[model samples]
Target: MLPREKYIQISLEINLFYQRIMKEHMLLIETHLPSVETALITEADSLKISMEQILSETVILANGNISEESIESHSIVTPFTLPCEEITSKLTGATINTNITMAELKLEAGTPSCTPWLEMEIDDINRRTLNLLDVIISYKKKLMEWVLNCKVFLMIYPEMLEHLIREARLYKRILNCLLDRKLPEFTLCEELDFWNNIMGEHAEFIDGMLDPTEKDLKEKARGFIARFERLVEECIKTAEKLIIQESLVATEDLRDYEIDATIGLLECKIRSVIPPILADHVLREAYHYILILNHK
Candidate 1:
């Protein structure tokens, strides 16, 4: 009974509704990552649609320019071959494929238009945004790697040490912040889950070393060191994964604590065990990294 235009509009609306649903559905279940699924079912439910869906797969061709929605699809990713005009004066020999890409994009050739157009430049804010993102996720992975190592340490060690616990808690927070989309340095939890599984391993190693027998104390110490190395490797691997996967963060992030006294205590202990120079280097690097992130 409605007018023709009304019927058409209704049909279009129905199609759009389906499109939105499909986009959401594709986003949630398609990735096949349980973490992503959990996020989709929880915090990201509202996002329903990913940035990719919102952006669409369509490449923007404006003012003889071409760009893809994803960085991986950019021409820079996969380059083709094109011929040069300098070498070949004849149009037959001249080709258009590779060289014309960035320098001279091939649009539907037409006379230059005088109509005004908006000009945007790639600048600092964009660069900083990307770099900050890289750093946050990078450090976040570092934190997780430590967590995994600590986890292994937990399974093997007899007890936890205060320092290991403290670092574990700090690292957990840094990861939570990354998820929450908070700047790399924020705090959400009341108590730090300080001390990692490695602390327990360290305690076990030291306890064994103090024992009169159980002669494998030196071997045990080496095992503890090897575990530490594994933990660091896990952290690095985690950072790389998060960056690649572009993992989401939780709502509340973590902040740094006033750990000057604790750090000093830790430094003293570390100096006693390791060379003064190595201890100093570790302390300085940690201090500088903290200051840099905190200032931002």
Candidate 2:
């Protein structure tokens, strides 16, 4: 039987094996995630349109002698308030028809104006205003969600992927070396439980993206990526420990070669795998659906 260090070394090798699986998983997820910056920009543009609609409603309400009571009760958003004032000022002096002018005067004088034309216009404003307000409120909630999603995307993907890519190259080096030696003594246990666990996690991430019941892919993926990142960190630590411990048995110059070779292997692996993974249909579908939802 091999010495305990050799067994521990095998266990470490097994750990590195699973680390590569996780990197691939992360790559798949990164590939599938929607362009968050684009999504946020789209939402911001929609919110801007909603704000404009609210302002337009305000103008109609003011011009048509909408009651002070209605404006006070419904004008919860600040942007609508100043525009109401501006519309009143513009209508007070502008030469429209006599009826509309009287309605404007009556509105400024704080009396209810009841001309049917004015009343219908005011009614339309009320309906549209209420609807626009609801949209603005919903947009505010979405803004909060977007803030969180953007933070996760910014913090996680660049650093986490880079680490995983680096660690994976290192593992490939060790794998290649072990393979070259034709060492049959080192066997990953039959189950390859660690690899299975990572694949399970990958499946769950994909399921979240695909499940019709899931409301927001970015939100779900954000959580999964954060959790997966923690797991990757632990796996990288284990891999690095193995590399350091193993290097203690080698000459200084040889140790440097091992480290460089491992890094080079991971870089090569990432180049070969990532672009094709990103092009996969599952990832493309996720991006498509997310864009559709954002536009809606």
Candidate 3:
């Protein structure tokens, strides 16, 4: 067992580390992440709306020019007829050929070829579009692989640290009880040692949570949860034992002070001290953390 002063010092250091992690997590959520997500969503939505509107307009224009009615009429094509039926057949053919050639020339004159500059501009736009898509894909991957992973860890670790601190303080109180000659009923040497070992194991798990290079993290987290459940069970058993011991003390030959004192201590343990150490909130939070890990 560590000396009281040494334990207090270690507790203070761990708390400071926890504070730092909390600050970083706050900064990420409050400032950095939200701003980036908002900007990306806004820009992507605007671009999508604009492209959809343009596509709709293009479809409408195309339908107007190539309607079913126009297609049917165009399909009923026939050879041209000369106005003078009495004219020679050779003259009619020459006249028809001349008009057809003139029309073809006129059509050719009206059409324009694509300029080099326009082609270059289109190529540049395509290249930039591809680059932008690549960048967005890369960003998404990194956000998932790094940012989101880190966020889950950051969110979970501080909470884990908080529980560890509580357990540490609980252990310290148990140590105090061991040392104090007055409260022997609260002092079971073997039970205290067992709980201390559990606390130590929990401390090690917390250290792993804060570690950047821990392997098989989710597996370890599951193990921690199993151990935590056992710890809770042990704590409940301890509480039951304390209650039974106090209740079994026969009232015969006992002063009023002694009876009152016993009751007072029992009430304190059940109502106040034990509640904080073996909290429902902690269990719920630990389970919630596990869910988050599984989700990620």
Candidate 4:
């Protein structure tokens, strides 16, 4: 069984990272929809707001409850996160809570322990997050089906919708594991396979969204896609420490690329429909993967 403190720490840390991410996914969907799609846009906006409220709660709960290693991993908030949110909020005409980012930045890592009441609070938060994810996951699937059937046109890609669903499911799974007071039921190679596929899809999405004139950037994105695809294949074929190491290296490289791309997007030096916050979001995921692989 997982220790109480460890459980609370993991629950808060995961929520802090993923709630913000899921909210941004909603914002992207909301902003990209046509004005005529009022119902869809409102649903997305409502989900986004729900996620924001949960994230705010998480930040308050996690202020002194997170681990130093997790904070140092840069998986929660990178230096570019604030600027990316600021610029993306302006461009998308959506409100992003930069205060959350600021508060996260000020978070002080605490010892590996918590009070019993805090543990109970985290338990409640996890349950609430699980319910929210269910709604958002259903919404994402509905959107994907509509797009696939050609019943609606969205500026967002169908694959992007699918990607959002996968992430929400992953978040739900993690919360369920923590709530159960058990470790995640994933082998190292299985975990690698999941994140590797996510990274590959991110590259594909970036490649598809980039302007045709940006040949060099597109080429780099393709390279990452191919590299991660190969890693995923290796993961399927074998469970080895070497594969984890390779994945770590690849993720580090991709993290750097994402950082550069995010900066370019913020500086208006890159041409793409990708939001700056989206770039930073992918970067944070890569960083999160790196932390896991490094632990292995």
Candidate 5:
């Protein structure tokens, strides 16, 4: 691969890591949002307008795409603590209004919150879901910009660079829908298996790169390359399987994502990077040793 391509591959791998973290954040948000929404949907039966208002505000925070300023001005997230059962028992049934300003509440020994509490609910789930879709779509623009101009593509190793670039292409296409809530079970299972296999192969790649060349270490390098190729072949097969099963598996799981289908993805990229870096390390040592010997 050319220098430019190699550099780009590295950048792609880095960006892929970024994408993986974003997925983790999404998973965390989803973990709580659904149940919170379910509870609100059940309890907020009589206050439709109030509930809807709260839902809209929560959805904005839940999506987590807007600026803090935008959210703050709109009070996208409420901050308040409800009275414990002990305190509530003293007051019978007191209703809290949404209009209460958060700053005014005195948070002392007993009071827990400054403003009224808001709950996320299902009536506005569609909005949040659609917002997620938009975020994923927006990611494409970022991916394109990185793919086209990332510094990693500037590396000298053209062959390796090209390989990484091609893989990034596959990765980018798959990224489109990886965040969808309604994921396919079987396909996710298959992708995870494939991702694990790739990780194993990548580990070997790292070992091969870091290893000092013995009397026959070049032979080992060749063997390692063969194994790497086999792993790639397996990955290709897995990719094909996804395509055959569903026309858009890539849209759901990037070649680099660490979802159920793409877990261990970062480790593999790290592994892939190690080999060349190791080789360079050894090469530098060889050049220094040769100079010393010649001087002697």
Candidate 6:
């Protein structure tokens, strides 16, 4: 079984990062829908608000409960997060919870021990997160089905909907393992396969969303797509430490690319339908994958 302190730290850190990501996913869906699709748009908005509320709770819980490593990982909130959110909210005319981001920025690492009260709070947060994941996962699937069946037209791709669902499912699995007081059961190769594929899909989305005139950026995105595809193949073939090292290098490169892209988007130097927050979103995920690969 995992130690109580470790569990509490991991749970809060995970929620702090992923709850924000999931809410941004909802924001993307909400913004991409046509004005005529009021019902779907409203549902997406409500879901986004729910996720933001949960994230706010997580920020409060995590203030002094998480590790210093997580704070330094740049996976929870990048330097770009605040500026990106500010710009994106203004551009999209959407209400983003910069307050939560501000709170997260103030979080300090605590002693490596969990009090009984803290443990109870972590348990409650975990339960709430799991329930929220269920709703969002089902909603993502519904959107996927609707898009596939041509019942609705969304500016977002069907594959993107599937990608969001996969992320939520991964978060669900991690939270469940925490709730069970056990470590996650994934092997190195399994972890590589999951995150490498996610990285590849992110590259694909960036490529597809970029303006046709931005040939250089598009080509760069395609290169990342191919690179991650090859990494995934290696993951399927072997679980060697070499693969982990190689993945780390590739992920670092990708993270740099994401950072540049995010900067470009924030500075109005990139042409795309991709929001600045989405750019920062993918950048954070790449950084998260890098941390996982390094730990492996």
- Winning model by lDDT: 6
Alpha-carbon local distance difference test for all models: 0.28, 0.34, 0.30, 0.88, 0.30, 0.90
Candidate order by lDDT, decreasing, is 6, 4, 2, 3, 5, 1
Per-prediction TM-score to the true structure, in the order listed = 0.19, 0.24, 0.20, 0.97, 0.24, 0.97
Candidate 3 all-Cα RMSD = 36.5
Q: Candidate 3, TM-score vs. the true structure? A: 0.20
Candidate 1 lDDT for residue 134: 41
Q: 1-296 in candidate 5: lDDT tens per residue?
A: 22322222222222222222223222222222234344422332223233333333433323322233322321112121112211222332223332322321221112111121211122233334334434443433333344457522221233322333333343344332232322123343344334333333433433444335322433444454464345445544555544333312321222122121112221232232232222222222222222222222
* Residue 296 shift from truth in candidate 2, angstroms: 42
Candidate 3 — worst ten consecutive residues by lDDT sum? 74-83
User: Residue-wise lDDT of candidate 3 within 28-67, one digit each (tens)?
Assistant: 2222234346654344334333323332322222222222
For every model shown, the clashing-pair count is 22, 1, 0, 0, 20, 0
Summed over model 4, clashes come to 0
lDDT (10s digit) by residue, model 6, range 1-296: 98988888888888988998899999999989889999999999999999999899888888878889899999999999999999988998888989988888888998745689889888998999899889999988998988899988999888888889999999999999999998789877788989999999999999999999999999999999998899888776765887888888888988998999999998899889899999999999998998887787
Query: Candidate 4, 233: how far from true, in Å?
Result: 1.3
Kindly state the number of residue pairs that clash in model 1: 22
Q: Which candidate do you rate higher for TM-score, 1 or 4?
A: 4
Question: Candidate 5's C-alpha lDDT?
Answer: 0.30
Candidate 6 has what TM-score? 0.97
Better of 5 and 6 by lDDT: 6
Candidate 4 local lDDT, 1-296, one digit each (tens): 88888898888888888988899899999889988999999999999999888888888889778899889988899999999999988887888879889989888998745688888889888999899999999998889889899887889778788888888988888888888898778876678889999999999999999999999999999999999999988876755877988888888899888888998998899999898888999999999988888878
Clash list (residue pairs), candidate 3: none
- Positional deviation of 287 in candidate 2, in angstroms? 45
- Which residue pairs overlap in candidate 6's backbone? none
> What range of 10 consecutive residues in model 1 has the weakest lDDT sum?
247-256
**Residue-wise lDDT of candidate 1 within 205-286, one digit each (tens)?**
3434333443454344445445434433444345543422211110001001112212432334211222122122222222
TM-score of 4: 0.97
